[model samples]
Target: MPSRYVIVGGGIVGLATAHRILQDLPDADVTVLEKETAVGTHQTGHNSGVIHAGVYYKPGSLKALLCKAGSRSMADFCAEHGIPVKVCGKLIVATEEAELGRLRELYERSVANGLEVKLLDGPAAREFEPHVAALQAMHVASTGITDFAQVCRVLAELLVKGGAQVRLGTRVTGIRADRVLTDRGEIPYDTLVNCAGLHADRVARLAGADPQVRIVPFRGEYYELKPQRRDLVNGLIYPVPDPQFPFLGVHFTAMIDGNVHAGPNAVLAFKREGYRWRNVSIRDLAESAGYRGMWKLGRKHWRYGLDEMRRSLSPKRFAASLARLVPEVTLADLTPSGAGVRAQAIRPDGSLVDDFLIVRHGRQVHVLNAPSPAATSSLEIAKHIVAQLSA
Candidate 1:
């Protein structure tokens, strides 16, 4: 008999894994369980949709390897399916003099990762982006943008066509040695893969595994430039990340739809799926607040958190932060856009699990943390996860 494969989560990674399973084990019975009414309803759908070009990751890391290969594969996948994608590239600008050193370090790392990049000075940067204000910049030519949600939709379609089951509105309630107990019923399987983004850690514990990490959600708030003000950015523009604090600061992205998204300032969410300040959850908040790692992270970055909160509350402040990269930007040109909650994993020491964290427990595989570039690397991530089933 063919093996019965079950995947928890309908995000891109889960769907992609299901897709890979059909490719490798054509006769295997495959089923995907997504709690949401549709696929990619969460992290896969709610993102700026930038196709990362393997920049900023440590050399020879899983993130670097997968991202480098995934960017190319992602762009190709979109082209094959007729999904719109743009290889418009991006600029990592140094607006402050103190950032020049970091900019150079980033450029070197980009080269070490085998990416083709060019370092440009302030005046040279303007040749590519007329309004950008920078002391120096590194031009990463392979960065692009697309709608990742659309990619998920195509993956789901392919899975169904390949004779794999795609079940929506099915939430996993419990897991046992041989079957998955869900809201709908039970799914017996030979293998289980966890791509549960926000609730991945919880799902692992439900299956009797100690992941040694906690899922802490951080809300990335964003705004868009008014259509008339869209000329401010030609493509993607980022800052030399602040080493003193976590996260890549606010940047401008010219999305595939011609809308420029800006200002995804990171702040801890009170709830796991919270997109706005008012969307709080008592349970999620209690879990996060009570986590020892959360307290340690807060203690180390309390000042930065306060600043992010202020920026989150005030559009003027957020625009001021954006103005560092594009001097022409002003508060008047800004309008509210959507927000995305990132499921970042932190250990007991408060250090983030920077790489892709996947651990196997008997017949189960759990993805503990997959941050920023996960969308770009979903296809490759799926391959890596499927490889584990054989080991």
Candidate 2:
């Protein structure tokens, strides 16, 4: 019998890993378990769709290194597979004098990451993004956008073509040493990979791996531009991020469909998979509220957390934040959009894991955290995970 590998979760990471494994070992029996009826239903589908330019990560960090390579690879893959991807470029604008210093720092980091970038003054920035207000900005010419759902579908297609089985609506309830207990039945496997996005820690624990870290789901809420207002944004427009916070501030993105989206304030979700304001699960809420990491994060960034909550509940407030970037945007030009849950890993020390966190335990590997650039870096992250696997 061929060696079996069972991977939990069917997001981009899981699909990417399955694809890589089959490519590397064609005879291996691979199975992907997704609780959702379809792939990319969570973060991957609701994401801003920006192909990050690796400007914010620390030099030599896994995120920076992989994002640079993965973004290019993602573009290439999309092109070869006939997926729609637009390399429309992005701008990190410094709207106020206080942000100028940070803008310069991002520019330096972008150069260190070996990406092509140009510095633009306020007027120069306006030349490209006429609606954006900024004193200075860094134009990352390589940043772009794509429909990751399409990418996930292609990945599934490729996996099927390579003879791998993806089992949807199959929830892995537990992971024993040599078997995965699922809602349908037990899957016997020699190797198990945990790519569970919002519940990575739980999956690792189920696999008998003691992951010291915990998965904290942060909800990022967005607003879409009205049909009349889509023309205001030509591409991606971002703010000079606050260095202290892990969440990127509200920004504008010209999606592949030519509509613009803005705001994704990072607020702690009451439920892991909660998107709408009224949706809640008591089990999910207790799980989050009881975690020691949750309190630690709250104690550290209570103010930012409160602000995120305020914005999430009030569209007018969210619109105000977006107006800072595009002065012409009015309350009427905005409408409620879907929210994405970010699986942020909070360490025991109360610090957010900004970089990709990967842990190895016996025959199993767990992805603790893979943030914003993750979608852009899926291919490279897959390669890294495969390389880390002990043969």
Candidate 3:
């Protein structure tokens, strides 16, 4: 009998996995189970859509390896599908002397990762991004942008064409030894893959796997520049991120849709899918608050958390943070856009997971942590996961 594969979640990673399986094992029976009615409704659809150049990841890590390969693969896939993508590059700048050292470190790391990068003094940086306030900058030529939702759509189409099943609105209620119990009914499977973004940990537990990491949802809030002020950004403008924090600070992104976005301040969400402060879940809040990891993290970064909360509540504060990179931007030029919740995995000791984390139990594989570049690295992540399954 042919192998029966069941994948939970319909985000980019899940769809990409199904596409990869069909490409390699044509006769395999693949069924994707998604609780939502549509694919890419969460992180994949809510991201900044930047094709990362492997700049911020540690060299030799899965993120670095997959991101470099994924950027190229994603661009190729986009080209093959005729999906619009732009390799418009990015500038990581240092507006203050203190940030110059970190900027230099990122440049060195980028070089070590074999990426095409160039260091730029302030005036030279201005030539690339005229409005950027920079003491120094590193130009990453490989960074670009594309609509990931479109990519997910095309992947789903390909999966369907290849005779794979995409069962939308089907929620997996339980996982047994050789079958999946769903809200609809029980479905037998030879193998299972969990790509559940926000609730990966819960899904893993259902599959009888103890993935030590817990998923902590962090909401990133964004603002768009008014149409007239869009000229202030050329491509992508970023700050030399604080090495201690996982989030890259507020930056300017020239989206594929011809608009510029700024200031996705990372804040703790009251609910897993909470898009606004008013959207809360008592159960989710209690779970997060009760987690030892959460308390440890909060105690360590309470100051930073307060500042991010301020940015979430104050538009002027958000714009002022953006002003560090582009002085031309002001509160008046900003408008509320959208928000994306990052499913960050945290250990019991409070260290945030920094790479693509995958674990396997018996015939099941769980993607425990895949944030940020997961959208950019979806295709390559699928290749990695599939290769593991074959092994």
Candidate 4:
């Protein structure tokens, strides 16, 4: 009998892993468990849809190493599979002279990561994005955009075709040495993989793995350009990195769907799956408020947290932030749009995990932290996780 491979979570990462397992060991019996009625209902479904080219990551990090390769593979896979994809490129703009140094650093880092980049002055930057404001910018030409949710569907279809089971609405409750206990019943498996994005840490602990990290949800809110104002952004317009902050400041993105998405200020989510302030959970709040990591993070970045919350509640503030990238944008041009909750892994020390965190425990593997580039790097991440399995 073939080894039964059971994967928890049906997001892009989970589905991609299932596809990889079948490719590596074609005879393996694979199963994917998703709590949602359909796949990609969370993080994979709600995102900026920018295919990153590893421009912003620190050199030699998993994100930097995998992103360039992932971009290539993702675009290739999308094209071969008949998915709509475009290499529209992006600009990391430094609106003020003080941010110029950071833009140069990002350019050098992009080069170190084996990517082609160009440093543009205000005039050259305007040549690319005529409506933008910039003292200087780093233009990353290989950045692209596509629908990651659709990618998940293709992976699911391919998995079923390979004699695998894609089970929906199956919530994992516990994990024994050789099986996963779900809301429905028990699922026996030879090996298990946890790609539970928001609940990854909990899932790890359920399987008796001391992941040493806690999953903290940060909700990123967005506003889209009104139909008449969509022309303000040409491609992805990002901000220069500010080392003092935990997140990159909000900017504009020209999504594949032709909507210009702007302003994603990160604020702590009361619920792990919270998309709005009203979507609260008493249980989720108790766990987060009770965690030492959450308290430590608040103590450390309380001011920034307040600022994020303030911005979240004010559309004018969001527009001001976006106006730094494209001066033509205004509060009147904005329209309410969707949001995505980032499953940021916070260590007990109050530090956020900056790279991919994959842990192996006997027959189980848990992904504790995978942030922004995750969607862009799902294919490569799947391969890396599966490569760790013992033959």
Top candidate by lDDT: 3
lDDT of 4: 0.90
* Residue pairs with clashing backbones, model 1: none
**What does the lDDT read for residue 269 in candidate 3?**
96
lDDT of 2: 0.88
- Ordered from best to worst lDDT, the candidate numbers read 3, 1, 4, 2
lDDT of 3 by residue, 1-391 (tens): 9999999999999999999999999999999999999999999999889999999999999999999999999999999998999999999999999998898899999999999999999999999999999999999999989999999999999999999999999999999999999999988999999999999999999999999989989999999999999999999999999898889999999999998999688999999999889889998889899999999999999999999999888888998999999998999998899999999999999889999999878899999999988988999999999998988
* Each model's backbone clash number: 0, 0, 0, 0
TM-score of each: 0.99, 0.98, 0.99, 0.98
Clashes of 1: 0
Tens-digit lDDT track of model 2 for 1-391: 9889898989999999999999888999999999999998888988988888788899999999999998899999999999999898898888899999888888888899999999999899999998899889889988988999999999998999899999999998877889999999999988888998998889988888888888887888888999888989988888889888778899888899877888888887777887875768888788778878778878988998888888877888988898888899988998877888888888777788889988888888898898778899999998998898844
Per-residue lDDT over 11-66 for candidate 1, one digit per residue giving the tens place of the 0 to 100 score: 98899899999999999999999999999998888999999998888898888998
Q: Which portions of model 4 miss their true places by more than 4 Å? A: 244-246
Q: Model 4: per-residue lDDT, tens digit, 137-169? A: 888899999999999999999999999999998
Whole-model Cα lDDT per candidate? 0.92, 0.88, 0.94, 0.90
- Specify the poorest-scoring 10-residue window by lDDT in model 3: 256-265
* Model 4 clash number: 0
